[model samples]
Target: MAHANDAELYAQWLELLGWLDAEASARGLSFEKVADFPDYIYRMERPYDLPTTVMSVGVNSAGQPLMIAGVSPRHAQLKGVSLRLMGGSKHWHLHAGTRGLLEGKRPFTRERLAQLLDGAVRGQA
Candidate 1:
């Protein structure tokens, strides 16, 4: 069961990486993998208002990787974003046009992520 879960998580992460790569290129943003961890950072191509968003993939007790994306503003701790990737799914946990945390989940897409990235760099999310 654990092996199966690990394989599934790997597949999901691969898909997510592919989506991120394409999205970053298409949007003229920058994406990079962290050197010391299973993490990735996506940022603006040049001067931008938004902060860099880090996608940290941590291993759970079952050896499955869970991805949580958030912004780490200068002189601030990491803060949660509106979207996350877990259990082979993308979830939106924020209200539209607002950064307020909300209950329930919504489908996560690359377009939604693009908005989140924008918000992050602008220090709004």
Candidate 2:
């Protein structure tokens, strides 16, 4: 982890998103609809919430903090680095993953991200 800060942050974002999804599920909240953007994400809000939340999470690229969720031709902008949607660029991968999780669980968190990375490495989560 050359850039431990960014890597750690990326993992944390993933975990937080996971937690968010789980919490939302227990409350019987489901956001099956995705945002207008193709990114991996889904808007969520309480029954009487003021506004829907747009949550985006993913791996952070080196130099750039943008995370790549699903697939995008502009991935090269990160120069082949792993990144999530932290910067201005909307890394659809994060959006997609988050959107899916939001419908299932809550938002991802730091602990969850570590587990996810470990699972990914071991070929199991």
Where is model 2 poorest over a 10-residue stretch in terms of lDDT?
A: 72-81
Give the clashing residue pairs of candidate 1, or none.
Answer: 49-121, 50-121, 50-122, 51-121
| lDDT values for all models | 0.39, 0.33
Stretches of candidate 1 off by over 4 Å are: 1-4, 36-105
Error (Å) of candidate 1 at residue 39 is 15
Candidate 1 residue 62 Cα shift, in angstroms, is: 38
Q: Clash totals for all models, in order?
A: 4, 33
lDDT of 2 at 70: 26
Model 2 misplaced regions, further than 4 Å? 1-4, 31-125
TM-score of each: 0.39, 0.27
